[model samples]
Target: MAFDEGDAPGRVVNGLSVDVEDWFQVGAFEGVIERDSWGGLDDRVERNVHAILNLFDEAQASATFFTLGWVAKRHAGLLREIAARGHEVASHGWDHERVFRMDRKSFAADIERTRKTIEDCCGERVIGYRAPSFSIDQRTPWAFMELAEQGYLYSSSVAPVAHDHYGWADAPRFAFNPLPWSDLVELPVTTAQFRGKRLAAGGGGFFRVLPYAFSRWAIRQVNRDEGRPAIFYFHPWEIDPGQPRVAGAPLRSRLRHYTNLEKMAGKLRQLVREFAWGRIDVIAHREALRLEAEKATLHRASA
Candidate 1:
């Protein structure tokens, strides 16, 4: 998505991200969707994800898929298809736990488990992460440093902007390093400064919830006006609106989770056409290296 569609002092860098997991893998629904039930849902998972894969393939685009360890373990073929088609595999943690909710040891273990699972399935070492619910924010800022220590090259876990479940309200919207210890890159989800508030860009259910016009405007504002790359994220099930709806979820969440699924694919296609986009790793790595070089120059100058 373009940060500013028309006013770009710089080109809008686009990165598409997908949290690859079954419907049961989402954090909010973890409480309601028992993990044991996930195995039996494999067909549903592949069907949903394959549709997304096919869409990206049709666009001649690639994305970073932050996959659940459980899903990767059982659905190796899905992970393989994503890799075969040129997408990058990344970790979404095991069991979809909120990072801040777990102790450091537990959190690290989750990362390792998920990373290994993805690597085993895709034959590529997973180097990035996007925490479930965007939970690696201020409360779990340590997660970034820990991820670096675990050999991760970067993380897309911080939403940066505030939300009901997760955010580092003060963090930068563009890609940057989490300082003091982390060498890992932090790529926050795209949110634009609109009328002095951070509103979600073309990412996740937020994109689904807003009028398509608003999302396009937000993304364009970021690209053209703000001079930053925009990261758009969505789940596999989002495009599969016809999937069975869950029972007993909170009314608001049920609404948030299910509303407009049928329209998501069309919306996604519109989004891809409206802006230039690439894989998150490509964007993140290119930016990280550039930033590092810039930092080294500044350090030399200061010295």
Candidate 2:
């Protein structure tokens, strides 16, 4: 019962996405745990994810979930529940490894493994990938070519805004195909280009940590000024403040993940009400070809 484009009350925003991994699997905490130790946790991801799904159901919204292959393999039913509810199931990678951390062979293999796992779960060709922590920026440009070769039509992996962890400080705010890679659509997370600096507008720890009015104004500027759709993303755990907290992590990382947990659900509700948002695939279906063609035109014009 999700709302269609015409049904939403506000200006139609682009897409909404969720990174579907357990709280501990997040890249910010990756440095804290031994690789094998991550499995020892009791996999409360579905419990957390279902909460967000319930919220979306209440809002009459459809979204995309970038699922980890490890989570999908064990919780195929969870993946099915997502697809059953008419949301898109995309890949977050096999084990949530950042692209720059792995060589090309390992990165490609991870992508293939995750794509097959998700395809098996959903019985549809998975066509998108969101890199962990937006790790596939300029440092790992090969990711775009690899995603194109693997038949992925779009990537929402570039953050564009500068962050302590990752950002392509030079990338565009609106969707665009980078030089030499026109086949894959690059949907950088929505950020407003302000006074020569790119400030993140959509969800991230920044959205949670900063004042909500700032986020609202940023999206408004993007739509009114740029005439481009904005992208937003969030995590299920953000809505669940009472979830068990991880121990032994750095003070800063713990604060980043846990602070304002109680406020996330309310902030998200305000965001959805203030702007129109839809599933990523819907945006991709509409824009990918046009973007590719636009790139070709630009190339021809330059030549």
Candidate 3:
């Protein structure tokens, strides 16, 4: 499925998203900083998110904000502002809890609680979810079911690459029905082929660590070569280089989080200007429509 007929022949409206969590809540800091210490830490999320909103506004792009319940509750005004500005407000689990860390029951409760909190803040039903650190994997076969039960329509949760923290290397690279009996879609984050290997092209530490030109080329490859819209995501804290640094984070984590921090916003502005981007809902809707049209065409041909 493509974005619209108005686009130039070889373009698609890729999915751009923001994972709205504070800097202290990152998985990299999970080891060094206790979760209870979150409330006492400096909160840079609001200003950073506003900067992001302004960036999106300036570029005339819309994106999905997969927000944490804890963040949403504390920054209810910011959540309302995000919704007011025409971007989608979706759910990231409460306080950045990874799915693998929670059992089915706790996972279910997390889904319901977070969804309700986000909906209450934004005054809209939350249909999309992205797991913290892309933590949902084959071990949690019940993850999608829990989301389906909570009334989420799609999840941008799985990462189809090998990683030390989280990656389901065998999952499909694009959006697909993870559950045969339900309509919930599992939209794995984007990846690009390089030297006979698939690398993480969707944002995270990868975006910060890699040169901007490579990221541009990789995304272009995904759009032009694969004929599929890519889903790119990054956290709000990515743009805030001035934020307080976590003291005890490991060296590797420090490198991933801190490298190119000052350059992220400029890179993001270029990204917004150069590409066609939209919310996950819009892209997923187009995919569903494309499938329906294909089925109808096949039926007519068979007849």
C-alpha lDDT score of every prediction, in listed order: 0.80, 0.83, 0.89
Q: Tell me the spans in candidate 3 whose CA falls farther than 4 Å from its real position.
A: 1-10, 292-303
lDDT of 1 by residue, 117-206 (tens): 889888987888888878887677678777988898878877877677677888888888886555688888888886788877748888
Q: List model 3 lDDT by residue over 1-303, tens digit each.
A: 233344455568899999999999999889999988889989999999999999999988888999999999999999999989888999999989999999999999988899999888889888899999999998899999989887888899999999998999999888887887887888889999989888999987898889998889989999989888889999999998898987878899998899999999999999989999888888877776666687689899999
Give the top-scoring candidate (lDDT).
Answer: 3
Candidate 2 global TM-score: 0.92
Clash pairs of candidate 3?
none
Ranking by lDDT: 3, 2, 1
TM-score each candidate. 0.92, 0.92, 0.94
- Listed per candidate, the RMSD to the true structure in angstroms reads 3.6, 2.5, 2.4
Q: Global lDDT for candidate 3?
A: 0.89
Residue 296 error, candidate 2, Å = 6.7
